[model samples]
Target: MSPQTHINFTANPPKLHYKPHINLTTNPPQPLYKPTSTSVQTYINLTTNPPQCHYKPTSTSLQTHINFITNPHQPYYKPTSMSLQTNINLTTNPHQPYYKPTSTSPQTHINLTTNPSQPYYKPTSTSLQTHLNLTTNPH
Candidate 1:
């Protein structure tokens, strides 16, 4: 065998399985890495488990609530007039029957309060929303 052949030499270097070091000591702010419950539930409803990272959304915040309101994915974003009527109209227009309810007698008030037709009514069972569209638009 020639002297060149006998010499131990490597033409290519070994590839490194490189990975970034994580500092578990100091808590890193993970915005996108760990999504908020509001985001997960509101959007597509992610079924996968969250990574072992810090994200305490258990406590509610005004900022978080605002985020939900502004989010484009939220169902209440569009139909601005409807949202304003249902949510904002109460404070502005106190004369609204559903909001103030001055017409209904004491005896009938309880029954009307429980009725699903009322804007603030909460059905005992899971019921489909009946907007009573025919009230305004008659076919």
Candidate 2:
């Protein structure tokens, strides 16, 4: 009779070589939630001077209100009762169509600086010159 070799069924599993070379001192801790600004905007129909609707953030004390002007000279703003302040100024020549806009309120300042995670009202212009000038020298 030939001798037969029997394999052991209870052999140990192969070991995984894991290296712990993580640099704990090099990387800074990341923020869980980054800070962002929030603002509200009201839309106005240019074709018609009637106010369409007022859109705003669901939260309070962090809202910004804007009036969409179809014609820079002939502005059409809707009255808001949300207790938000309006701090907008635009400057233009008596003859030229171009104008500049300046934010006069603290909330406006925050909106200009931070990227508000809310809807913001923007004005429509026939040309790029009007857009650029309005922001710089807004009356």
Q: How high is the CA lDDT of each candidate model?
A: 0.17, 0.22
Model 2 regions more than 4 Å off: 1-82, 94-107, 111-139
lDDT of 1 by residue, 92-124 (tens): 122221222121111100110233344433223
Local lDDT at 39 for model 2: 25
Give model 1's TM-score versus the native structure: 0.11
Cα-based RMSD of candidate 2: 29.2
Winner by lDDT: 2
The weakest ten consecutive residues by lDDT in model 2 span 18-27
lDDT of 2 by residue, 4-94 (tens): 2211111123223311110111012222312121222221111111221331112112222222221222222222222222322233444
